[model samples]
Target: MNLSDSRRASIAWLFLCFAWGTGFVAAREGVKYAPPFLFAGLRVLGAGLLLLVICLLTKAKLPNRRQLATLLTMGAVIEGFTNICIAFAVFYLTSGMLSLMLATTPFWMVGIESLKPQGDRLSSRHTVGLAIGFTGMVGLLAPKLIGVSYNSHLLMGCLVMQGACVSISFGSLYVRHQRLGVAPFMGAAWQMISAGVIVVLVGTLRGEWVRWHFTPQVAKPFFYLLLIPSMLGYSCYVYCLPRIPLALFSLHRYINTVVTFLLGWLILGEKFGVGECFAVVVIFTGVFLVQNSSFTVSKKEPSS
Candidate 1:
């Protein structure tokens, strides 16, 4: 790519990262006017519908029966369950802290993948990375877990966020293993729609409808989540994937975490102190080690 193209891509990538980073705050603000599940469902559903239109305009191929089924299942786990957990988590944890917990997703993904019969065996480096990652987690939650702060609700929120991570990790593994032939955008659209339907149904059954309000405060953040993070951020990711290396693209994870931390502190008045900074460093260091390690086994490798 030329200098101008590179510069534009860099700017777009940073914008996407910022959008995702601020999404936590948007959701937090949105739920003040709507139930968490309902808000999540609407945001994702709006994005899905918009993307579906884009897919049609681009002539993206629709998934076949088997692919559709797989996508739906993925959506149920990743978007439905995962997003509900996240929405609930934000009620108890600050967006900055929640982002830190969510950053452990790569660790969960590695652990989950290792459980499969044909999955990668844990190498010494992987083991070390896991240990360090767990230590960082413990450090981050030490106050609550050790009865110093001892808020059961907060503890539950942390667990729920981790559950969300695990759910997404499993869904990712399924996608990796299946290697469906559908276009990425098409698959994402279908998954969002399926997840939206399920969550919206659950929210309605739980009587969130009676609680729903469409005031300006909620509407603003809701639209921001739909358009900025879910739609534009994802579209930018897809656009940049071919232009950048995977490792470089993955750096956005850490960048987003930092962005969330800053935004939460400045805008939401969320706490950020020495302890939190240390934990973030340790956790991100552990993730870096894991990513750079050669312990990951390819799916094509033969299992003995």
Candidate 2:
């Protein structure tokens, strides 16, 4: 692309990253009154319908059976379970700390990918980088995890927070392997709708629906969750995918860290100590290395 185009792409990417970060904060706020699962369900269901309308207006085809299955599976693992875990985590952990735990996803994805025989192999540099970063992440989270004698409620909360981390990691990996023939927005819509159904079912079974209150104070955040971040954010990312470069796209993870930290501090009164700052730097550096590394190597065998 020309210089002008490149500059525009950069700005656009930066904007999307910022939106994601702020959206994370919005989503966290929305869940304060609603159960996490219920909040997630409403967000996805509303987003799905909105996307579906757009698709219809543009004459997009519904997914075939294979694509439907793929979306359903992805929805279950990624959107459905991931949101459930996050809701559980929100009960115990500060959003900032929870976001830090999420920053561990790249490390886990790299480590898991290393086990594949045909794919890229992890290098010593990668290993060292991950270790340094992960050590700092642990340091940042250690205080919260220590001392079992605190409120039993807090202890259970920590466990849920850890579960959220795992859920998000698993979801990312699942998405990396999925194949769908439709437009990215349409594919995403399917996943959101499917996951939303599961969330509603689970939440209702858990009595969230029966106990739900819908005053304007609660409704305001819920509406924003459905319309802005959940629907608009997903659409914005998908729209940019065809226009952005892969290398630059990698920056989303890093930008997400910054955004989440800032929002957590600004909106939630979350604090970061010296150790947390150190950890954030290390984590960001490690992610940069991992994303940029040429982990794949292919050398043709000598002709016989």
Best by TM-score: 1
Per-residue lDDT over 1-304 for candidate 2, one digit per residue giving the tens place of the 0 to 100 score:
7788767666767767776677557667767776777776777777887888898899989889988888888887777877776767666666665666666677767776776555457887778778777676666556666786345555676466556666666676667775566777788888888888888878888889866777675688777767766776676677567678777787786777688888899888877778778877877777777666766553446789
The residue-by-residue lDDT of candidate 1 on 1-304, one tens digit each, is 9898888788888887898899897777777778988898988988998999999999999999999998888887788898888877889988877777888888988888788877886777878888898888888888767756778887999899999889888887776768789998998898899888878888898899989998888889988999999999998887777777778878888988899989988888888899878988999888877766775675765679
Count backbone overlaps in model 1: 0
Q: Model 2: which ten-residue window has the lowest total lDDT?
A: 149-158
Off by over 4 Å in 2: 1-8, 147-178, 297-304
Query: Against the hidden reference, what TM-scores do the models get?
Result: 0.93, 0.86
Candidate 2 global CA lDDT score? 0.72
Instruction: Identify the leading candidate in terms of lDDT.
Output: 1
Residue 185 local lDDT, model 1: 93
Model 1: how far residue 117 lies from native, Å: 1.4
